[model samples]
Target: MYPNDGFRELERAECLRLLAKVPVGRIVHTRQALPAVVPLNFRLDDDGSVVVRISARSELVRAIDGSVVAFEADEIDAGAQSGWSVVVTGAAAVVTDPAACERLARTGPQSWAPSPQEVFVRIRPELVTGRQLVGGRTLYGVDLPS
Candidate 1:
């Protein structure tokens, strides 16, 4: 039998740090009275938010804007038994500002999948949390004091 683990608070800054390094994450939001999770290539902004590029008409784009959303990023190394995960809950909006979008476009997302027009989405983090698993049994979490 496996042990039940408790969840801990993760620091805001640490969560951003881990998220910035991870290449991909799951962005979760509500749609049609249901929950939807989509894998996305994301870039972590300096202000503890995430920048993601998607297709202009993607369903996620429609559902995310002006809404509360959750974003999660994780990296696992089975060989070393070490891994880290970060979660950000916040409001999402479409980045329509030309200057900001240009700036984001410059850095580019770390991962690219087949898509149509490039759509830029930004998530302004209200809360962020993270945890790390090490040596198969040890779990360390960063507590972001509210």
Candidate 2:
């Protein structure tokens, strides 16, 4: 086996686990035919879906509704030079069901922004990928022959 580097690709289960621990992520979507990235707080559903709250008047409401988008979250320790990043690509949909919206409102992420977020958007992930760096190398636990 090759020399063990700290860098390694994370499995889907691990990726989702990391996402569950993060409260904030960037949502990448198309706005007016241009790419736009917005930082927001999010929650992970049991089924691996991402949920976020937005203001009714916010541009993201219209831009992300019924659209395909990318969502990313990461955590890094600069001192240790180790970190992990997770990216999720999926279709976003505005929650129009009153009952479902109510449930989300009670369980979804609470936004730090002053605006009153009344709209709940759900992103059903189609693809999920992640990578992590450990001890400045790309290897995990594989045993190498001398």
Candidate 3:
């Protein structure tokens, strides 16, 4: 742990492990020349890529595909005052291969929307960062559950 702060940097493998435990994340991307964030459920691919399932016609699909974006997921316990957050930055691409799509349909995260047509967008994790709050009631000068 850091001598001053209760937050500890998580290793890349630990970040991916923590990411796998969570089901939802926020995708940060550009929308109409402005930055936007959308909360969505996702799954971690075997290679650590983030896979999101959304409606094929979703504006997000077009906005994020082939673009560089950030994906963030976190688990926080307000009562306990502790948790972890992981962020992955990478290029988002729509899964266009029929065979891969079929495979994802069988194994990927189920969509939250009732859309007849859905597409899988995979974000290749080029950069991953994470931190864990070793929480308590207080830490150093700050208040936390250390």
Candidate number of the best TM-score: 3
lDDT of each: 0.78, 0.83, 0.88
- How close is every model to the real structure, measured as TM-score? 0.78, 0.82, 0.85
In candidate 3, which residue pairs get closer than 3 Å at backbone N, Cα or C atoms, i.e. clash? 135-145, 135-146, 136-144, 136-145, 136-146, 137-144, 137-145
What order do you get sorting by TM-score, best first? 3, 2, 1
Regions of candidate 2 where Cα sits further than 4 Å from its true position: 1-7, 113-117, 137-146
TM-score preference between candidates 2 and 3, better one: 3
Q: What is the lDDT, from 0 to 100, of the residue 115 in candidate 3? A: 91
Residue-wise C-alpha lDDT for candidate 2, range 1-146, written one tens digit per residue = 12343357788899999999988999999999998999999999878889998887877888999999999998988778788888889999988899988787778777777475478889997988787868555334545555
Model 1 per-residue lDDT at 8: 40
Name the lDDT value of residue 14 in candidate 1.
76
RMSD of 1: 5.3
User: How well is each residue in 49-86 modelled by candidate 1, as lDDT tens digits?
Assistant: 88888887887788999999999887878788777778
> Candidate 2: minimum summed lDDT over ten consecutive residues — where?
1-10
Error of 2 at 11 (Å): 1.4
Q: Candidate 2's error at 76, in angstroms? A: 1.4
On the 0 to 100 scale, the lDDT of residue 49 in model 3 is 95
Against the hidden true structure, what lDDT does model 1 obtain? Answer: 0.78
Clashing pairs in 2: 5-137, 5-138, 5-139, 6-137, 6-138, 6-139, 7-137, 7-138
- lDDT tens digits, residue span 1-146, model 3: 22335557789999999999999999999999998999999999999999999988989999999999999999988788888888999999999999989999999889976599888999999999887776674322433455
